[model samples]
Target: GAGVSQSPSNKVTEKGKDVELRCDPISGHTALYWYRQSLGQGLEFLIYFQGNSAPDKSGLPSDRFSAERTGGSVSTLTIQRTQQEDSAVYLCASSLALIGTSGRAGGELFFGEGSRLTVL
Candidate 1:
């Protein structure tokens, strides 16, 4: 069943123009995460994948941000040349983890209702 979902929840661009955000996870979960919260700021963990491991982007903040999680689920977060501090609110999380992956030892993450980036 679907759970996590994000998309143009709110996006207004114009600065450098370059955006692509979308995420839909929660069907057998394979561990996917991407976060970026501003306007009060506090959740900035750009990437993380489980299953094949080796997909942690170290909280991507520069390089115009980037993300991908194809087969393991659905994920997309690309900001090639946008600016304005890259606006904020692009949260996406998924986790049906078996007993591994993060805090408390991985097992908590089911968010999606974000994707709000405005840079104009």
Candidate 2:
């Protein structure tokens, strides 16, 4: 893929259902990020993965939210027991390097159109 790719561009699930969102980042990119944006709200950081370092999951809202990156390329975010409040646009982004590294002020990020999840 030429850019970040996310699956199931739109999903409507009943409350308490489980949903999995997938992201495939640009080839050779080392950093991947997951963000959530609710209606009329700003993007909320969910998780970050950089190379082999431990993923920064400080932004996960609860134990019901989890994510994993495999082979350093693909990633998946799982939301268990989804609630109406969980409805949002889940975005995935990839960067070649971490911000402020490699002489770059802030590395550029390639973002996917995002997966819109709606819990009814």
Candidate 3:
């Protein structure tokens, strides 16, 4: 019955540093997602992983952002050479759907409180 869990609820780093954010999804959930929200901005899709399929990285802002889901349970989002513009709330969500198609059909996303990142 556990929901998505994110670690390092808050992080502040110097510009140009590298940071890693972690996420653990609910059991048996085959779909995982990463999103980011900047100040005064709506949530933006970052990446997606479903089952053993290749992750969708189209949403990542640049080459500095990347993510990986291991064993289909835990996922990590890494921002290399963090920049001021990268400061935002990183959110992780999971769903019972095996594919992203479920959300369009009314499937819901269980989200974590989000990890706030700040680059000074």
Estimated TM-score for each candidate: 0.31, 0.93, 0.92
lDDT of 3 by residue, 1-52 (tens): 4878998899999999999999999998888888999999999989888864
Which stretches of model 1 miss by more than 4 angstroms? 13-32, 35-45, 49-57, 62-82, 85-93, 98-116
Q: Give the better candidate number (1 or 3) by TM-score.
A: 3
Q: Cα miss at 2, model 1 (Å)?
A: 3.8
What's the distance in Å from true for residue 73, model 3?
A: 0.2
Q: Which model, 2 or 3, shows the larger lDDT?
A: 2
What lDDT does candidate 1 reach at residue 24? 83
User: What lDDT tens digits, residue by residue, belong to model 1 across residues 4-97?
Assistant: 9889799999998999999888888777788889998798888777743535676787877877777777878899889999899889888877
**Total colliding residue pairs, candidate 3:** 0
The stretch of ten residues in a row with the least summed lDDT in candidate 2 is: 98-107
What are the Cα lDDT values of the candidates? 0.80, 0.90, 0.88
lDDT of 1: 0.80
Q: State model 2's lDDT.
A: 0.90
Q: Write the per-residue lDDT of candidate 2 for residues 1-120, one digit (tens) a residue.
A: 598999989999999999999999999989888999999999999988897454577899999999989899999999999999999999999888865577754349889999999999
Instruction: Give me the displacement of residue 19 in model 2, in angstroms.
Output: 0.4
Which one wins on lDDT?
2
TM-score, cand. 1: 0.31
